[model samples]
Target: MNSPDSQWSFTAPLSAVPEAVNACLDQYFADSSKEFGSIGSEFGQAISYLKDFILLGGKRVRPMFAWAGIRAGLEGGGGSLSVPFPDATPNPKALLSAISALEFIQACALVHDDIIDKSDTRRGNPTTHRKFEEEHRQKGWLGSPEHYGISQAILTGDLALAWADDMLLDSGLGHKALHKLRAPWRAMRTEVIAGQILDVTLENTGSESVDDSLKVIEYKTASYTVARPLHIGAAMVGADPQVVDMLRRIGHDIGLVFQLRDDQLGVFGDPVVTGKPSGDDLRTGKRTALINLALHKGTESQVKKLRDALGVVHEEPEINDLRELIIATGAEETVEDYIRIHSQRAIDTLTAAGLSDAITSELVALTTKLNDRKF
Candidate 1:
């Protein structure tokens, strides 16, 4: 059932979601730091790094999509042509806090992903594991700094997941809504891990087929990043099953394009802009669709170049040669085309989801921003 106060006193402008969600995260961090302060100075310091890793900066894509889905679900619940800010919801802050949990899940994903990928930096800051490793070195701690770093980062990721569940429960969404959210919430966490496992397995299997790459993104990125967040909101508001399904469908395609854009940036983007070295994906031997297509479409020599350099090349010149091969093989062009087409298809589905034009336009804008991102 919808909340007693059907309309919030104020509606959040679309521009306010990131800021609002950030505020929630800031508050949570403050409370958490205090609650966990008694553990130990070393533990306290570790928490600080985890806090900074999360709050330093982010695009807040997951929370924004969660809020967007809430908006859609609110409309669906009311059968209204337009949504009032959080109509049929609990307290504005409460509901916002509930959705803001997505950020914590995101935090968990990023920290663990860095560990798995052996990434040095994220958004121009040291990755969590790297930060911990450096701390161990600086303090002359009594263990392998690399091993210490990974262990701490793993715990940090686990803490973030714990905090996510707590945040949702404490957000005052009420038991009924929380109960409804259980499936989506659980599914999101598991799917992301499953996807990560697939990603790791792919690196070893050396399968660069486009289908294989797509399969990895299907669970690892699309579902966790977009679809499940949307599903969470829809379920919370008890939207029609059809609307929920439509959202899931749109989220999948949109999520694909989102990651596709990320793959492009991983190779072609400037280090300063993208916050990672160019060709990082190639260095890591990620079996991205871009790599798969290049392997499939390239001439024998061009294919051999990618296969040889992938997971091995480090020098800029070698990376540049690989970049050229990707472009020369037309794989980059194909990925660009996929991003455009899938983004449009997702938008088209959103347009038909019986939402008000304003809501639809905002979601479309979000999709455009995601695809058009340079970083």
Candidate 2:
């Protein structure tokens, strides 16, 4: 268990992540460009778009979690766990390559998610599908701009997904470590797809049950976003089964808190901070926990207003009215309480894991950051 006075330092600074991941990404694109450039300039253009989309700003949360997991595994191997500023592991490059694969997976998801949500912007920039759509319009393309955009975006996501596997396979981990990666990697991919299907189905059916929403969270966000990344990292080091189980459990709770925060931000966070329009989730008719709670508790008129506002274009005043209705029902507060509960649950799990103090401190800090983040 971590003591009260334990000290922790992040082995790699968050600022270093972009540089490290971009190096690998740039190499992959350069190699890909050489091979695909012979095919056509269109392939080059698509690659460029993927490059830009990936290099654009993100929190790099998945990679950070993986890094912490690596450190945790290292610490569990009978060392003090506190090391110097750099070179925290035997093969920093291998770890970076393995973890950075998460970014490509994330890019694939966001690209497809933007298409599904009809989101115009991500990280304060035009989304991948929207970018292609605008390009098609500007070029006066022969096909429907929307169709062109969706088609190209789907292909781009496929490309990213393929490249993610390539990156992981080529990450220079031993044959055994790579073999260990297969289960979690496969599970992560399948679970996120299943979750996405569930989410879309729920939206179409207008189901707003809390149970359904939580199911989405568990399969969609929790497993892919946090649990698998931690598991993969722990696998990279061949950590003990008990340790891996503890990390997965901790990740489950933390992932829920992360998604809960994201749901709150969708309704209430600033566009500048969250990089999406206000009330975007409401507009998209996402069957989130907050929405389920509102539907369950809201008055008849309030429910009617919410139902009407969903899945439709709404003016600012109408959106604000919906927001007020959600808040008035105390759904926002209810979700907030869940966030607190999950956050503490995660901390408690960490405390009981008997991990090194330094690793525990870093995980604790991550939990706090995720819990309190506005974005």
Best by lDDT: 1
Q: Residues 1-375, candidate 2, lDDT per residue (tens digit)?
A: 221112223366444555666666666677778877888888878899999998777777888777767777777732222221123344566667778888888899999998998888888889988889999999997979999999999999999999899888887666667767689889988899899999889888978799999999999999888898888777777777888888899899999999999999988888877878888887777779889889988889888878877868557787888888899988999999999998999899888888878778878988998999989
RMSD of each: 4.0, 5.6
lDDT for residue 117 in candidate 2, whole number 0-100 = 81
Give the CA lDDT, 0 to 100, for residue 315 in model 1.
89
Candidates in order have lDDT scores of 0.82, 0.81
The alpha-carbon deviation from the true structure for residue 92 of candidate 2, after best TM-score superposition, in angstroms, is: 1.4
Candidate 2 residues lying further than 4 Å off, grouped into runs, are 1-10, 13-19, 77-89
Q: Please state the error at residue 180 of candidate 2 in Å.
A: 1.2
The segments of candidate 1 whose C-alpha lies over 4 angstroms from its true place after superposition are 1-10, 76-89
lDDT of 2: 0.81
What's the true lDDT of residue 238 in model 2?
72
Instruction: List, residue by residue over 1-375, the lDDT tens digit for candidate 1.
Output: 222133332245455677777777888888888998888898787778878977788988887777777778776434221222243444667668888888888888999999988889888889999988998899999979999999999999998889899999998776667777799999999999888898888777867779978988899889998999888877776767888889899999999999999999988988878878877887887878888899999999988888988989898998998999899999999999999999999999898778867668888998998999999
